[model samples]
Target: MGEVLWENIIVSILAFAILYFLLNKYAFGKLFAIMEQRRELVVSQLDEASKTREQAHVYVEEQKQALNQARQEAHEIIERSKQTSNKQAEQILELAKEEADRIKVDAVREIESEKTKAVAELRGEIGSVSVKIAEKLIEREVKNDQAQEELVDQYLKEVGGRS
Candidate 1:
């Protein structure tokens, strides 16, 4: 019985050793190579993903800067337009004032001319009436022409002084 048990244990041990040796020689190296390749591939993919995330962050920052610049330009344009409009309004007011002053000066000159014309016309009418009255008085008094001329001159002088 002891011999039979011993033979059985020895045979089992030999079978396990043969199986372990065969697997190590044929499959272990290939399996380890495949696992190493998978590990390298995973590491490269993680590095690419990190680079892409950094690029995305840079692109977002650039867009924000561009947007801020555009806003500043728009504000500048609005301010310039306001300044131009104010200048135009001031110019228009200045022109209107000049025109008003010119019109007032013209009116004053026209009024003075009209007053001079009226005064001249009144003087002429008064002179004709005085001459007619002197002629009537001379016919009644039998006066000489020289005496009549002297009286008329004196009367005209008195009227001129009063005016």
Candidate 2:
């Protein structure tokens, strides 16, 4: 019975070695190759994902720069408009002032002309009154020189006072 037990033990050990050798040569090699292929696929996918993430970041940055540039251009346009509006306002004010000055000059000229005309008419009336007075005195024919002189002095005084 002891010898049979020892023999059974040896046989079992031999069977385990053959099975391990066969699995290492055929089944384990294929299994390991499959595992290596899966690892390489996962690494390539991770690299692709990283590259895509970097591209997305660059796109976001470019959009932000474009937005900032657009805002700056809009601000410049508004500033230009304001400057143009101010220039127009100043030009209008200057034109108005010039017009007012021209009107004032015209009014002064008109007043001066009217004054000159009035003075000439007054002089003509004075001349006509002097002629009529001389004709009346000649018709009266005052004989005394002293009386004529006194009458002339009195008329001169009256004319001066009226003027």
Return the TM-score for each candidate structure.
Answer: 0.64, 0.64
- Residues 8-81 of candidate 1: C-alpha lDDT, one tens digit per residue: 78899999889888878888888889999999999999999999999999999999999999999999999999
Local distance difference test scores for all models: 0.86, 0.89
TM-score of 1: 0.64
In Å, residue 152's CA in model 1 sits off its true spot by: 14
Task: Estimate, for each residue in 1-163, the C-alpha lDDT of model 2 and write its tens digit.
Answer: 4356878788999998999899999999999999999999999999999999999999999999999999999999999999999999999999999999999999999999998997887788778767877876888788888878877787787667656
Clashes of 2: 0
Q: What are the runs in model 2 whose C-alpha is more than 4 Å off?
A: 1-33, 135-163
Give the clashing pairs for model 2.
none
Q: Name the weakest run of 10 consecutive residues (lDDT summed) in model 1.
A: 134-143
